[model samples]
Target: MNTRTGKVIVNQTITADGYSAGLDQTEEHPFGDDGGDGWGSSLHSWMFDAGEENRAEVDQINAASAVIMGRNMFGPVRGEWDRQWNGWWGDNPPFHAPVFVLTNHAREPQPMEGGTTYHFVTDGIESALKQARAAAGDGDVSIHGGATTINQYLAAGLVDELRLHIVPITLGAGVRVFDGVPPRKLEQVTARAASTVLHVTYRVLA
Candidate 1:
C-alpha cells in the first residue's frame, strides 16, 4: 500500500507523568481516575476551562479532514454492536469529517448528524489508515485517542507529527502513552505554555 498523502497526526492530552487515562474506564467514568466526573473532564479541562487561552490548539483538533480512533475511545460497547450506541457525543460529534474506528468486530458505516460519519474497520490499523487517508484527500488525518491506539501507530512508524497537550497532574496507575513503542528521535516544532496546559508539537524526525 502507498503511504498516506496527508500527515498522520496524533493529538492527545496527557498528564505530567505521561498517563493518558486512569484505570477502570467505564461509560460513566470515561477517563477513570483522571478526576473527571465524565468524559474528558479531567485531562481536557484545558480546553473547557481555559477557553481562549488554548483556543487555537482546540480548533486545530477539529480541523482535521478525517480521524482514526480506537474502538474503546469511541464508546464502551464491547464485543458485538449489541445496543444502539452511536458515540459519547450526542447526534453530532465534534469531528465534522469521516471517522474510522479500529475494531475487531464488523459494523456498517454509521452516519450521524452533521457531516460526521463513523466507519468501522476490522481489517487492521493500516487498513483503517488507508481508508482514512483516502477520505481525507489532501487534508490532514488525526489519530484520535486512547493510549493503546496511538501506541500501535507510533510503533509502526505511521505517525508523522505528534501534538501533545501536557497537563500538570499525574495518574500513577492508568492508561499510559508509548508502552511498547521503541526509542525514536523527534524534532521539536513548538512548545507554548497556556494557563491550564503546555502545548508541545513534535515532528517525527525518523
Candidate 2:
C-alpha cells in the first residue's frame, strides 16, 4: 500500500545552529564532542530512546528502498579500507535496504542482517546516486547525511524533498548543514512540532 516513485530525498537531524555533527568524530564519538561528554546522546535521543514519539518521521526514513550516506556516517574509518570496520551499526543496522556509502577508498560490499548491504562507492556522488536509484526501483531513495554529503547533492541540484528534524540545542562550532550549498528557495510542505524536535518537510524547488 506504500507505493511511491523513486524520488531522491534527504533527511537529516541538525542542531539549532544547523550543524549535523561536531568536531573530532572518531570511532568512539560518532557525532563527535558537541560540547557534551560524547556519543551525541542529546542530538539523537529522539531516535535512540524516544522513537515512538517521532514515529511518523522514523517510518518515512525507513520506507526508503535504498540509502546513500557519507563515509563518516557509515563509520569512523578513513583513507583506505585498512581496518575491518563494517560500520558503526554492529551486525544489524536501522536501514534494512541497500546502502551506498560515498568514499574514495574502495571496499567489497559488506552485507549485514535485515537485508541491508553496504556498497562502498569509490567514484563520486553521481555514481553512488545512480546505483541507489537503480536499487530503489519504485520506492524512494534517501540521501542520509552528515552535512557534507547532503551539501554535495544539494549543490548538484539533485534532491527532491528535504526533511529536517531540527533539535532545540546549538553546537556553536560544528559541521553545519548547508555549509557551502548554493542558495535556493524551498516550498514548505509539512511541519510538526514535537516535545524535543520540530520536524519540517520541504519540496526543493528547481
Candidate 3:
C-alpha cells in the first residue's frame, strides 16, 4: 500500500497480536532475535522454503510489474555494509522485476545479476508509484511491505488488494501492521490454510 493514485497491493506476515516487524530490526538483530521471541523459524520457512503450494502463490504475486519496500526494510546489513550487499538473497533474487525502495537518502540505482533493478525513491510513495506504474505497464504494482509504509497507503485508501499471512504466534510488543490506518473494509477473495501458514487474500473495498 504505497501508491494512492495507482493500483497498489500489500503483502505481509502478521502475528496474532498484529505485529509485523519484530522489536529492534538493527543490523545485529537483522531478523530481530534479541531473545528469539519473534517468528524466527516460521518466518524463515515461509519466506525461503514454503511448500510448493505457497511457492506457487508467491510466484503469482511476483508476476507483478514492480515490488516496493520501505527504507527500514532496505537498511544496511551485516554491520554498516556497503550498498553492494543487494539483499539477503544473492545473485538471482526471487523478485525478477523492478523493485522500488522508498528512502529519504538518495543513491545510484543498483542493478543485480538477475533482472532486478533496485530504484531508490527519495521522494514519497506517490513518486515511487508513478515510476512503478510506468514500469509495470499492464501488470499490477505490489507493495512488499514494512508496516509503516503499508499504513500510509492504507490510510489513503490506495491498496487494490492485500495478501496477508497470519502466523499463530503473538508478539505482545512490536510493530503492528494495521496501526494508524483509516477504517476500511476488505472483500475476501481467497482463503487457504496450510500446515505452516494461514493465507488470506482480500480485495480492498474502500
Candidate 4:
C-alpha cells in the first residue's frame, strides 16, 4: 500500500515584477517580449546557459511524479484542437511522468517517446489536481503553469509549496503570478541566487 502522501507544489519562473509571461503570446513568441533580446533568452538563460550552477533547481523541477499545466503552456493550439500539437518539448518531454493539461476541449491521451503521457482534463482545476495526485502516488504533484493556472490553484488554496525562479528583468504588462490569488502567509524554505536567476522556495502556511 502507498502510505506516503504527495505534496501539491507549484514550480514556475517569473520576472522581477512577477510576470510569468508577457502579452502577445503567439506561436512565434510564446513568452512574449520579455524585455530582453528574445522571448525566453534572458528569462530562461539561467536554466539553459548556467546549467551547472542551477542544476539542483533544475532537478527539483523535474522531480515531480505528475504535472498539471494549462492548455496555453501545453501549446498554441486552441479551440477544438484543430491541429496535431503535442507540446513545446517535442517527442521526449522533460517530465517522464503523467502530465495533466487543463482545457475546455476534449482530447485523447497523447503518449510520447519517454514515460510521459499527456492527459487532457476538461473538467476543472480540482479535477486535474485530483487525477494528478492519484497518478503521483507517493511522489509530489507539480502544478507547472503559465501563471493563470497557478493563480487559480493558489487562489483555491491547493498548493503546498511554491518554488519560483525569479529573473532580473521585468515585463511592464504581462501575465503575472498572484493576479487573483487571495493573500496567504508563506514561510520561506530556501533561497539561492544564480547568475541569471534567483531561486526561492516557500511553504504555503495553513
* Whole-model lDDT, model 2: 0.90
Residue pairs with backbone overlap in model 2 = none
Candidate 3 differs from the real structure by a C-alpha RMSD in angstroms, to one decimal, of 4.2
**Selected candidate, larger lDDT, 3 vs 4:** 4
Q: Which 10-residue window in model 2 sums to the lowest lDDT?
A: 33-42
Off by over 4 Å in 3: 1-7, 33-40, 77-83
Model 3: worst 10 consecutive residues (lDDT sum): 33-42
Q: Which candidate, 2 or 3, has the higher TM-score?
A: 2
How would you encode candidate 1's per-residue C-alpha lDDT over 7-102 as one tens digit per residue? 899999999999899988888888887766646676888988887888899899989999999999999999999998898889989999999999
The root-mean-square deviation over C-alpha atoms between each candidate and the true structure, in angstroms, is 2.3, 2.1, 4.2, 1.1
Off by over 4 Å in 1: 1-4
State the C-alpha lDDT per candidate. Answer: 0.91, 0.90, 0.76, 0.93
Off by over 4 Å in 2: 1-4
Better of 1 and 2 by lDDT: 1
The candidate scoring highest on TM-score is 4
Q: How many residue pairs collide in each prediction?
A: 0, 0, 0, 0
Q: Estimated TM-score per prediction?
A: 0.96, 0.95, 0.86, 0.97
lDDT of 2 by residue, 61-173 (tens): 99999999999888887898889988887899989999999999888999999999999999999999999998999989999997899999999999999999999899888
Of the pair 3 and 4, which is ahead by TM-score?
4
